[model samples]
Target: MNKIIFFAQTRELVGVDKLELAVDQMAISQLLEQLSLRGNKWSLALKEKTVLCAVNQTLVNYDYIIQEDDEIAFFPPVTGG
Candidate 1:
């Protein structure tokens, strides 16, 4: 399983901050597709805003490999403070 963390608005939208999904070899798009199946709010949240994804503390490309026990985070684009 991989560790997935939702931050800021993502967490609120999902109604959970973290989850362990049984996916180890999927691309970033596949991961979002699975999550989007949750319900209307989740799909809407993604569609209505720019969601940023990070894998293992690094900003990643769409083809980035997801491995077992990896840390993934999803959140809206952040602005400089």
Candidate 2:
């Protein structure tokens, strides 16, 4: 199983900190698309083109490929004060 993690407002919006997906491997973009289908809130929170992502604790782009047991995190782009 793969793990998906949401951070900051992304967690609040999704109402979840983590989720288990029965996927062996997939691109970050593909994962996001799948999660977005959960509903309106999911779509709005995860479908954003600018969402930041990381896999296995390393920052990655949408094309990053993740494997089974990998941990994926999603968060919004950081903004300066």
Best by lDDT: 2
lDDT of 2 by residue, 1-81 (tens): 888899988889999999988755678888888898888888888875768898888888888788878888999887779
After superposition, candidate 1 runs with Cα above 4 Å error:
none
Relative to the true structure, candidate 2 has a C-alpha RMSD (angstroms) of 1.6
TM-score of each: 0.88, 0.88
Off by over 4 Å in 2: 79-81
Clash count, one per candidate: 0, 0
**CA lDDT, every prediction?**
0.81, 0.85
Candidate 2 residue 18 Cα shift, in angstroms, is 0.6
